[model samples]
Target: MTNLRIRAVEAGDLIPVDLPAPRPDVDGARWRRTRVAVADGQIVGIASVALSAATDSYFCEVEVVPGHRRRGIGTQLYAAVHRLTDPRFPVLARAMDSFPLRRRFAEALGCSVVTRCPAPWIDPPTPAAESWATGQQAPAGYRTTVIGDRPLAIVKDAWASSFAWVHRAFGAVHIDRIPQMWDQYSKGVDPAASAVAVDRNQTIVAFSLVSPDAWDGRTFIVAETAHPDQAHGTQVLGATVATSVTVLARRGTRRVQLEGHTTDRHTPDVMRSLPAVGSDPMDILRLEPPPAVSRGGCR
Candidate 1:
């Protein structure tokens, strides 16, 4: 019983659960948090229901005391998290394939496997300047411009239609995610970190959105978008990374990842550019609402 402490929370429990701080990126009204403390006032577990644009639903996370195993704290914490689900949008989680128990526990919570996602990675000190210079050999008529080099409003409108194209190309199972609009893609985004390739007529042909993976700004994720073809893919990928590399180097960041669903289209020319590819297959789990709840769930 090594100083373990846990109890049901109530209005006057006097237990100081360290709730997660509010994040502006998450939808404020839908965001939720819970914490259960242990002996010495340390966190034994925490359950959070946050926004996941990819799932078009709330994503869940349950943290437990490190190095404490063979205990039921995780089960208890997830039970509490299950109670917070809205049942309208799909409540989902990305269970790591490396951890079999994570998938088992999620199943216990009524989640079922949906699909796997690939999390590709790239090392620091990207390709030299000359190989991927600004506008390096863009499609004959195409040139390069960054997010901030052009007006924000025009850029948004130009790329608005491209979002649908990207979604179609990927055909993600969570079709609701795919950034249907520029506004959804721009939140918590650094304008300077993203890249856009445009034609002489002032039209966006291909683009890439790269932003710090977290507040630390040391690592970035690049979401590439372009027409479905080899030549266009190579051109867009090179130019986009080139533009974003400059932005990242300025911030002293040397690592970047290109994350996408397993079903998304892949171009060898683009993939070969960054040899270090780490595919973390995320097993998405989803649960349908109960019959009664499903009947009344719709607004």
Candidate 2:
């Protein structure tokens, strides 16, 4: 590497190279900030982090041009990012099955696999409003509607509270449970893209939320939760998918996506209810800086 330099950059700098947008999960301000490793004015790799005061950990993405590997660019880029994000926040990223080098690098940096499996994805073809339907009967006193039709705070509260009870035995990160982070997420996509089921008392009992897929403008399910009382919550989920697809399609949305963890109890029901085009086999890796590097955050 000649004259290799790692420096902070704006969102625009990353656009040309096609890095995925920072996770919509954040608090206070957006954290799509990028630090790039460049050699002789050519970008070699980019390292970025998701920041939110409300969450216990962070999510990060790093990309080093395949040809630029074995030269230490990624290590420097990662170190640069930790300086900006509090090193105390644990960071996670997906390691694709085809990219063993990325897995090795992430592992070398103290990351370990956390997801039960590569997340599952579903992209149902957008159907006409008249064609979309979920036949299950709504639980007594429960009614489903577009999330925006309800009060924002009620929806937000339900969104925040669901994190604790949904999958009791299986531990996982719930980024949207934090209101401020949810603030960042909700701002990025239409609230109509979300659906919620409310009980007779008007308390939200089940819900599903979607946002624009960061890599593309298509819809992606950012969060979902269902009350345990109703058919393992599938009816609500089914209604949610049906509502989202019909509404979004009316607005010209051609497709919708949802991701599931392998161990999640709802995975099977979700798969059976909707059609899936394919899945990206992925491993979620958790990362923390080394003691020496952690002392100063992201130096």
Candidate 3:
């Protein structure tokens, strides 16, 4: 503990520490502040806190290197991030359930689960499995196309509108933050494997966002969404997922992950309709404000 030092760093200066790089390309990434715990000139723990206009909350991420756990390093890193968080808005931390230590740390801070989701890994459709979705079609008057055919702005709006309910604790996503959010979520995405459903007016009403999992090249993440106003959203979503997953399997992706939260009505149904192997569940924890204290005065 004597040689431990915690200092601020720019996005470029971040040492991986096995955490996702909050790349600076996001438009609002400049507002994100990072801190690292260094001992003997080597980074062993990292923490970052950023205000997202899209979610209207302070988002935080913290990680300590394997050999450095059980020390107060994680607590110190988290303290740095909490100090940087704006108290006006709630703070949300995403800790994978697979890591009980991380989750326990968040719980110790009075954080409670806001949402629970199980991301399932499904085997790429074989010839027999392919037949079911292979013939699926978009809703009447809607045509299927690659997501790249549409402008990102349009896609962003459609995506936020459909998925905003899952993040209700944080509020709706602002239009300006879309680019940064997309850059973060769509890394290594397969353009051909991502599909969209456009109505006759050339408006995108539904989409399937497909990207290779960052940790596993053979595994892909598949996210599907459709506008709630669309009377046939279910059909559109099914068709889009069918189209995207087929192309992903054809491209040699071995496993596809379908993310579904208990709060989402559409995605859970869509995921259940598919042939999935197993799931990895996780929870999003939101820090609750401490109870106000009363002051006593001499009368």
Candidate 4:
């Protein structure tokens, strides 16, 4: 075993670190520094947080080298990230189904199991020409359009209103924690890949954001979805999925996969609507300092 050390990531180290494939538009949004764990001068674990401008909330991701499992390294890494967080910021973490220990670790913190589902994968389903054509039919008051940087402000506002329920369901601390969500999206790798549905007045009613997966050459991930209100929820979701399918088809991609918590209820609806996709499992976890302590070090 090597001596373990944890520190903030540096510029030179940025390119080499195996970061989770970012959604296409993350660059426009700002990201906080990531913390990495090194052992014997080699990096072994990593963790970082992202804030969504539309929601003003933060979510975290953490990973550890396979060989170093069962130690408290994951826990320590989580605590370190939590230390830098604002107490009012609602934080979320996903533990893949393969990682049960990580789930337990998250429970030891204050997070509850919000949702779970099979990790779903979508490949070019034999494009049902009829269904594809049907999807192109714009809903009665809504028209589909590609989102551009100029309209990001309106989209962000609508997104916040539409996804507000998600924060309540997930125990998010507060909105406004992340101010760069839409801005980052505006600068994403392929803005053309994103689409939004708007009403007659040109008010954005729904939107979907997608990005290419660096690890899997042909796959693109759906990063975010927002709608004008709950009444239009299903329409927004359907439009988002359809838009992704259409884009992937045009790009000649054969498959797509969306990461979903194994416990979330919406997974079923997602599967039912897009039956061609198959669900697999992923794990999600979150860690926070014990309530009695104000910070990782202590009150």
Largest lDDT belongs to which candidate? 3
User: How does model 1 score by TM-score?
Assistant: 0.65
Give candidate 3 regions above 4 Å deviation: 10-30, 127-129, 148-154, 163-169, 183-188, 218-222, 288-299
Best by TM-score: 3
Error of 4 at 103 (Å): 3.7
> Per-residue lDDT for 141-185 in model 2, tens only?
667787665554557766665554443333454554466655766
- Which residue pairs overlap in candidate 3's backbone? 54-174
For model 1, the local distance difference test gives: 0.55
- At residue 268, candidate 2 shows an lDDT of 46
Q: What lDDT does candidate 3 reach at residue 276?
A: 69
RMSD of each: 7.0, 5.9, 5.7, 6.3
Mind sharing the TM-score for model 2? Answer: 0.71
What is the TM-score ranking, best to worst? 3, 2, 4, 1
**For candidate 2, which ten residues in a row score worst on lDDT?**
290-299
**Pairs in steric clash, model 1:** none
Write model 4 residue lDDT over 83-135, tens digit each, in one string: 76667756667665556655665665556544554556666444652274245
Better of 2 and 3 by lDDT: 3
Residue-wise C-alpha lDDT for candidate 3, range 124-188, written one tens digit per residue:
65763376467667878988777665444456666666556555534665656655666666656
Candidates 1 and 3 compared by TM-score, better number: 3
In candidate 2 the C-alpha lDDT for residue 259 amounts to 54
From the highest lDDT down, the ranking of the candidates is 3, 2, 4, 1
